[model samples]
Target: MLLIILGLALWIGAHFLKRLAPDLRARMGNSGKAVLGVMIVLGVVLMIIGYRGAEYVELWPKVQALVGINNLLMVFAFYLYAASGMKTAITRKIRHPQLTAIKTWAVAHLLVNGDLASLVLFGGLLAWAVVQVILVNRADRNWVRPAPVPMSREVMAVVGALVVTGIVMGIHNWLGVQPWG
Candidate 1:
């Protein structure tokens, strides 16, 4: 639990730092892109290690799987993720699709995962996502609302997101720990 908390703190801290200190972040990106990249890599590596360390956590019991509902939520999360990327029309409406994706992803997981660590990780992310969107809305000069994109693009987004979501779901067990273990 400690390891998981620490790892998440580091990972989320780094991301939040950028938003809170845009000038500092910009300076680093401008003058030390390579170094910044390395730092990000190291941070991610530590987060993975820390999360793995706590994956064997018996601190909380596993919740029974609601396979059908869980899958449905994941599918919607993927749709939002993919919708943000496609330029067909939806992309023009929202300034940030990926953040929207994160919001959806976090919420979806919260419903499926009933553990302290899962709550911490997903809840923290969801909070951050809300903050980010609020900040962007406040900071941006103009907000454009575009028309709906073509149906084909939505379909493509769904397909693309499904593939990526499938891979992540598959590897999540090996990467973190078992669902019911």
Candidate 2:
């Protein structure tokens, strides 16, 4: 739990460095980009260690029964994840689908897995989503839609989600976490 919390902290803290500490970002940007590089490495390492330290959570508490609706959220998560980084009209319409997807993922997990560690992990993600949305709103960045996503990209997105979902399921033993475990 400590490791998990530390990982989340490092991950979230590193993310906040830019939003909460723009001056620091400017300084780092000015200093030949060393600070940004260090921050990225440190954040990624901490998150992996923290995630690895978390216990295998199989039987989630029964606050809400796992159901098909929850699965819908996961599918939406897939869509958001898929749309990210694509230069298409879909992104312009969705405008931060990835962030929205994170929110959905956190919420869906929270509804299904009612454990302390799950709560901490997903809850932090939920909070991060809120902050991200707020930050985006505050920053007022506009998303311009380019050409529509090629039908192929849509196909690729579905395939990517399946792969990710499958990988997560396959590694449930190592992950100590599962959507349907």
Candidate 3:
């Protein structure tokens, strides 16, 4: 649990540093970006290790029906994440597609994972995403929505999302976790 908490702290702190202390982040420049990247990666590693090793203290039994819902949400989450990068039509409509995707993904996981460790991991991420969106909106009030892209781009984004989701499911299965329940 300590490691999980530490990881979440590091992840949240590193992300907030840029928003909360813009001057400090700007002063560091590219070096700061590199450091932040490393910190984020390390935080993810710690969270994974901590989550895998932590004892499962079930808060509630997993909802069987939610499993299908979770999977569906995951596909949408992945699509949103991909759309953010591709600047798809949805990007013009959504202010923060990537962050929204994170929230969706976190919520989906939370629905299925009822254990304490899962709660800490997914819930913490969900909180982070929400706070991040708030901070970003506060920082930039005038958001210039991206121009709409061609339909082909939207199709590509959906295809990419499906491929990524399949790969993720494979990885989860490889880790001895059944992604589709």
- Model number with the top lDDT: 3
Instruction: Give lDDT tens digits, candidate 1, residues 112-179.
Output: 66666677767777887888788777778587765776789978987887897677777877766443
lDDT (10s digit) by residue, model 3, range 1-181? 8889889988998999989999999999999988999989889999999999999999999989999999999999999999999999998889999999999999999999999999999999999999999999999899999987789999999999899999999999999999999
Q: Estimate the overall C-alpha local distance difference test score of candidate 3.
A: 0.94
The better-scoring model by TM-score among 1 and 2 is 2
Model 1 clash pairs? Answer: none
Residue 16 in model 2: lDDT: 73
Better of 2 and 3 by TM-score: 3
TM-score (all chains, Cα) for each model:
0.75, 0.77, 0.98
Report model 2's TM-score to 2 decimal places. Answer: 0.77
Better of 1 and 3 by TM-score: 3
Candidate 2 residues 52-141, lDDT tens each? 667766556655456455666787687678778654345767777788889988888778776677787888878988897888777777
